[model samples]
Target: MNGIPNELTIERRMAVPRDAVWRAWTEHATEWFCPLPWKAPEVEMDLRPGGISRVRMVGPEGEEMNLTGVILEVVPGERVVSTDAIAPGWVPQTAFMISVTEFIADGDGTLYRASARHWTDEARQQHEAMGFHEGWGKVAEQLEAVARRIA
Candidate 1:
């Protein structure tokens, strides 16, 4: 897809197969969801539309960030879209971004892309200023490592 004014993306090619990457994403998210030294101690994922998707991250200094969202779409091992636009049971909430994560088979590995689409340019800028590149890139590398281990 072409660029949207309020979207930020990360694209990575993993040496692990699609199934392994999918497992790393859905079944073992806490293993790689957050960057090292900043662990996702708890993760709750139900890979279905409207299902709960939660992650609790704790940094080296004990700074915490809890993300609670609902899965908005799922395509088995291929794709997942989640957002904080609404809470469980479709309740309205203040939304910052919608995350779209996709994994596709490429040779013996996977082509992965994750995009964060914000409702406003200001929100997108906020995410970027918050170290989106360094943070999310580390997490993606973390996911690749976890997947490689089980591959």
Candidate 2:
């Protein structure tokens, strides 16, 4: 609260058009969004303003983490904003967060960026210590693959 907020900004170049990148963020593409070495078992996406997307992943120990959020805004082939407020059925989130994802055309490809906003400085530090870079980085790498496949 006294200093500038801490955040993680990740940028990746995808060998795909903006539209293809959009698909990878939608319901049908949740599988690929799962960072490798983990398996996604379920995905439900309602891709529109106020719509919701829920994804369930299975860890190595078969533990499942279900994440769900509502779409705050969606600009086809441009950007998507979503709040990690509630889970499926509008259940409260254990760790609240908001995400803004953008896709910029980079001449024959797209520049993809996703930023996460937390409520407190401590939360931000916690996320950083938790390896958001490695976790999200892996997912971003997977995103490039998914986008290229459909490009």
Candidate 3:
């Protein structure tokens, strides 16, 4: 849970300001959180420590994946860390992974890094096999487009 062995990370150099990127993530999450053909119809983020971060993604054929987690950290326009290991009020839940997203200033744009920290090697492997890179990469692209549009 603390090292790279059980984690998967992806990064993208966005063509938008860091604040815009952060807004795309925090305010327009549902618009770009999922890969194309899959939409996030519902997303609720409190954007503070111990707050709720929930998203429900719906696929083209109506497939759904709901993720409800607790925000562990939040540095406005900089970083956010959330985990399914716990819910609001510090309630424990069956954890899948801890998600860390960073928005770093890069010249006039932003550098986005998103990491998924699994609880075990098996979980990490499962996520990778499930197209973590492709999925996350697509989402990043979508996020950049949204940020650029709203910038």
The worst-scoring run of ten residues by lDDT in candidate 2 lies at 1-10
- For model 2, the local distance difference test gives 0.76
Candidate 3 local Cα displacement, residue 30, angstroms: 1.2
Best-to-worst order by lDDT is: 3, 1, 2
The TM-score leader among the candidates is: 1
The number of residue pairs in model 2 that clash at the backbone is 0
Q: How many backbone clashes does candidate 1 have?
A: 0
For candidate 3, the TM-score is 0.96
Task: Provide the TM-score for each candidate, comma-separated.
Answer: 0.96, 0.85, 0.96
- Residue 52 of model 2, lDDT score: 86
Ranking by TM-score: 1, 3, 2
lDDT of 1 by residue, 1-151 (tens): 3768899998899989999999888878888998788889899988889899888999999999988889999999899999999888888899999999999899998999999999999999999999888888998999998899887
Clash tally for model 3 = 0
- How would you encode candidate 3's per-residue C-alpha lDDT over 18-111 as one tens digit per residue? 9899988888988999998999989999988999989899999989999998999999989999999997788899999999999999999899
> What C-alpha lDDT, on a 0 to 100 scale, does residue 74 get in candidate 2?
82
Count of clashing residue pairs in every prediction:
0, 0, 0
lDDT of 2 by residue, 44-110 (tens): 6676877887778988878888788888788877887777776546667775677878899999888
